[model samples]
Target: MERPRYESPVERAIREAQERGEFDNLPGAGKPLDLGDTSDPMWWVRRLAEREQLDFTGALPPAVALRKEAATFPESLTALRTEESVRAVLEDYNLRVRRDRLRPPDPRMPQLLAPTVDVENLLARWRELRAAAGPPLAEPSAPEPRRRRRWFRRR
Candidate 1:
C-alpha cells in the first residue's frame, strides 16, 4: 500500500479555507482566460498591467510609444493654459520624433515608425477648442472698502 503523504500547515490552512468556501465566488471565478489572438510572449506582463490598471506604454518601442502619444496629442493640449506652452510642447514632441526617426529601427517592431507631428495643424485645433470653450472668466474686482465705526458722536 502507498504511504499517505503528510500535509503541511500552509496546505492544511488552504484546504480548510477551500472547505469553508473562502476561495469561491471570487473575481473571474469561471471566466475563460482572455489570452489575445496572437501568442505574445509577454502575455503575462500585459495581463498583470490590465489587472492592476497600469499604463503599459513604457514597455513599447520608442517609435510605437511616440505614435500612441501623437494619436492623443490634441486632447493633451486642452490642459495647457497658453499658446506659448502649447507651442513648446509640440516643438518638444517634434524634436523627440525627429530624434527617434534617426535611430535604427527596433528589430522586434520595425514597422512602428512614428512621423513627426504638424505643429501648425495641432495649434489650429487647439485654438478652435479654446475659442469654443469661450473666453476665460474675468476675475472679481477688489471688495468695497469697509465702513469705519464712529466711536464719538459729533456735538
Candidate 2:
C-alpha cells in the first residue's frame, strides 16, 4: 500500500487556484510545447539563448569566435568612417588571433584554429567599398550662431 502524498500550503494554494479556473487562459495555453528535437545535448543552452536574445557566438571557443569575426570582418568594417579606424580594428583582430594561436590548444577543441588575416587585402576591400559607396556626405554647416536679443539697449 502507498501512503498519500501530503501537499504543502503553497501547493494547496496552487491546486485551489487551478480548480477555480484561475490558471486557465494563461499564455501559451493549449499550445504544444516546443521542446525541440532532443538530439543535441546543448539544446537547452540554445533555447535559453534564443529566449534571452543572446549572441550565440559569445559562447563559442576563442578560436571559433575569432574565425567567425574574421568571416564577418569586411561587413563590420563598412561602418567605420576612416581608414585609420579600419586599420586599428584589423590590427586588434590580428593581435587577438596571434594571442589565441600562442595559447596551448584546448584538448577538447584542438582542431579549432584561427589564422591571422591579411591586413592589406582587407584594407583594399575596404577602399573599394568606400569608393563604390561614394564619398561620405558632408556634415551640415553649424547653424548660424543663434543671436541673443538684448533686453535693454547697451547705450
Candidate 3:
C-alpha cells in the first residue's frame, strides 16, 4: 500500500488525470470515505440500510426479530385480533426461541438473540392492549318476552 517513488502506470494515469483537473472540485473533496465496518462481510448491505434509514431488524433471523418484537409486545399486540391470536403468536415465537436455543451457536455470528417470554405477562399486556383498543363487538340484544292480555289492553 506504499506510494511508488517511480511512477507506475496506474500512478501515471492518476497524475495525468490530476493534471487535467479530473479530481478537482469533486463531491466530498478532501473528506474521508465511509468505508464502514470493512471487516464485516455484509458491510455494504449494512451501509445501504444505514444510508436509507430502514428498519433492518425484520431482515434478521426469526429469533432476533422475535426478540425485537417482544421488546414492544404491547404495541405489537394491538395488531392482533383476539386473545387467542395473541397466544398463538406467542406460542410460535416461543417455539422459534426454543429452536434457536437448541441449535449450536455459530462461531462467526453472535449468540441467539431470542429471549424467553412469560405467557402470563404477555397475556396481561395483550389484555391491556385489547382494553385500550375500546370495547369488543357485542352480540344483539335478546328479544323481549311477549306479554299476555293486560287490563289496559283488549282481551
Candidate 4:
C-alpha cells in the first residue's frame, strides 16, 4: 500500500477551510512580510537588530537603547544643526587666532607702538615728569601789540 500524505491536524483544517472559500478574499489578500503594518515589538526589534548588526536574542545594549531614545527624543533638528554650526565656527575662529599669533607682524611699520617691557616704570616716569613740568611760560607778548595799521594808511 502506498503511504498517504501526512498533514498535521491544524494544517489539514486550514487547507480544508481554504478549499471551502472560508478564508478567500481576505482584507489583506496577499502581501509580503516586510511590507505589512507591523505593530509587534518583535518585528521592530528584529529590524533594529538587522540594521545595527546586533543580536536580537539578547537584551538591548545600553548604547542601542540610548540611540533609540535619541532618535525619537523631542528636539528640533534645526536647533541641533544650528548648535553644531556655531560650535564649528567658534573652533575655526580659535584656530585662526592661533595661526595669526604664530605669524610675524608687519616689518614695514617699525615705528608702530609695540608692547613695552617696562610698562609700569615708563608710565610712572612719564606721569612724574608731566606733573613736575611748569606751565609753558607763554612767550611774553610784545610790550605793545603790533597794530595792523601803520603810520601811513593805505590810500
lDDT agreement with native, every candidate: 0.84, 0.87, 0.81, 0.48
**Model 1 misplacement above 4 A:** 1-5, 18-46, 107-111, 137-155
Residue 95 local lDDT, model 3: 85
**Worst 10-residue lDDT window, candidate 4:** 110-119
Arrange candidates by TM-score, highest first: which order?
2, 1, 3, 4
Winner on lDDT between 2 and 3 is 2
Q: How many residue pairs of model 3 clash at the backbone?
A: 0
TM-scores for all candidates? Answer: 0.67, 0.74, 0.53, 0.21
Answer with 1 or 4, whichever has the higher lDDT: 1
Worst 10 residues of 1 by lDDT: 104-113
Clashing pairs in 3: none
Per-residue error (Å), model 1, residue 18: 4.3
Model 4 stretches astray by more than 4 angstroms = 1-8, 30-60, 63-155
Candidate 2 vs 4: which has more TM-score = 2
Off by over 4 Å in 2: 1-7, 139-155
Candidate 3 Cα deviation (angstroms), residue 39: 12
Predicted candidate 4 versus true structure: per-residue lDDT over 7-92, tens digit per residue = 78988888789779999887767964563347775777667767799854246433333344334322212222233443453344
Total clashes for model 2 = 0
Q: How close is candidate 3 to the true structure, as a TM-score?
A: 0.53
What lDDT, from 0 to 1, does candidate 3 have? Answer: 0.81
Error at 121, model 4, angstroms: 45
